[model samples]
Target: MLMLPAMARSSCERVIVSADPAYPPLHWYDGKQLRGASIVIITRILTDLGLPYELRYLGPWKRVLYAAKNGNIDVITTLKITPERRSFLIFSELVLNNPVAAFVKKDRPPPFSKWDDLIGLRGGIARGNRFGSVFDEFMDERLNVREADNLETAFNMLLANRFEYVITGYHVGQAYIASANIDDKLIALQPFLIDSQNLFGFAAQSPCIAYLPAINKQLEKLHKEGFIERALAQARADWRKTPIIGKN
Candidate 1:
């Protein structure tokens, strides 16, 4: 792990971090505590740097984004970069590369060869997510998009045949399917929509913004040393042992 210079590190003490409580295997509320790969990795990084910090399980995914945007929260553990979000947050280097894919009922899979194939299909997406700049723009202008408050709701809607497909992070969708025991009923389409990098970002108006350089440096080191990979592997194992139920 890379160590920040003492002065730079000191400024980051007592930082406040927040993430969606339901995004599991990456981050989630385990009834009493916030737990997941990102949470565990980030906590270790902060501890190793001797920076005291607070982790918060804010309301929903949208609420977490709202808090981070207004500087009510210091850091957000995982988010995809977009022009709108860039207005309120300064992002760190890539923390995890999340592949975005579409889920469909096994009986009625769509002909999904490329991005353009999704244009006319009815699809569900989480309310505040941005798959990538290209897909976001496409959704805005062309796709038949339906927004849901969370992934579980979106998946439920898809299962009920309310929509033809639901787009989500590949691993997250897989975990949700296994947890909900819907793998036999649904399938993820081939050729991901995009590979999005999950990042740690500070609110633009945050006091912790000054420490972003140091944070990025440490994050890069962690990524290089396989700390993040190890944490993710462990989290995947844990998720398999006890799959998480999707919130209704």
Candidate 2:
């Protein structure tokens, strides 16, 4: 862990990176603080770039986006820029473009494909997630949708069979499923819907507009050096454990 002296806190201000407590591998509240791959990567970028930044706790997506758009907050992590968001904040070059998938308890239902596949399958989604324009627009009436205030709640709901399906970035789904040790309970299904990878970067057009390009430079540098991959590999290694389910 890194630490700064007491005097440094008053002398220099770390730009605030606003985070909502969802979207694992990007931003979420760990037991101690905001953490996940994107959080770690952003921290690494700032340290490597010699920039000072702090993670700010934002309650939900709406308030955080409001703060970001108004420049009340300096940055936001892992935003998928639509035209509306583009107007409010500048966007950095994407860090990781991860695929999204439908996850459900294995054996309960057949797989889903196409937009209408969600019919009759009560789907739980993290509120305010950008699942691409096509799916985003369709999420309203096309699917029987249940919104969870947070990822853990969504998973808990799914675990209880409250919803037939839940969707998330593929790797995050895998990590959480592993964390729950619920191999028989939840399985990431086939025909991953939606395209374009979920990318992490500084909020571009917002208050941090002047700062993102530099972070992008650092991200590119990290990519070239394979530092990002190495970092993620080390992170996953730290959390490896036997499945909490199915072993018995």
Candidate 3:
């Protein structure tokens, strides 16, 4: 683990946490509040640390990030570490591996075996989504990908032929396919675009930043104990029982 810089203790009353409501099995909005493995893990860590925390349902994924950028939210339970995100947040230890994939219409799966194959294609991705710094830079400089407000809309547009593909988390795409009963319509291409790590991020300007080192230590303990695996399995089952509401 990398050592974090020393910082003054926080006078923060409670940690405010939020995540993409549209992302599932990891974290998602269940209409009323956030749910899934990320929530289960982070809240448990806070409790163990004897810290008060609030899991705010701040609408869309983009808004949740905006709140974090402005220090309105102290922690984001799960997100890939990207260069732009690092500007406003300090990330914790690796929480889990999040593999990103390109979803194409079943009948038109691209001849994609490498990143270079995607250059001329039109792709769709949800707003505030990032695969990694490399792919993000590639997308900006070489690919033609558009952003939709959320995954549901991006998938819908893909189905409507508005775009050739939609790039998102492989598991998230699968969950959406099952929930929407569109299993026959879309498929995630093999050889994932990128496999990224999901980590808890504390806002750089939030008083909660003081707890990052402690949080990282706890996260390391959880990973070694395999608690995160159990939580994810439980979260997947819970997600199936709840209805997935579309975000605006």
**What C-alpha RMSD separates each model from the true structure?**
5.3, 6.3, 5.1
Q: Residues 1-248, candidate 1, lDDT per residue (tens digit)?
A: 85332224435457788877777678877666677888887788777777788887677788888887766678888778888888888888888988889999999898888988988888998777778787789878988998998888999999998989999888788878877888899999998888778888787777667767777788888988999989888887787787653332
**Clash number by candidate, in order:** 0, 11, 0
TM-score attained by model 3: 0.90
lDDT of all predictions: 0.80, 0.67, 0.86
lDDT of 2 at 140: 68
> In candidate 3, what are the lDDT values of residues 146-207, reduced to their tens digit?
99988889999999999999999987888888778899999999899898789998888887
Instruction: Judge candidate 2 at residue 1 and give its lDDT.
Output: 70
- Which regions of candidate 1 deviate over 4 angstroms? 1-12, 244-248
Q: Residue 128 in candidate 3 has what lDDT?
A: 80
What lDDT is reached at residue 76 by model 3?
Answer: 90
- lDDT at position 65, candidate 2: 79
Candidate number achieving the greatest lDDT relative to the actual structure: 3
| Sequence-dependent TM-score of model 2 | 0.79
List pairs with backbone clashes in candidate 3. none
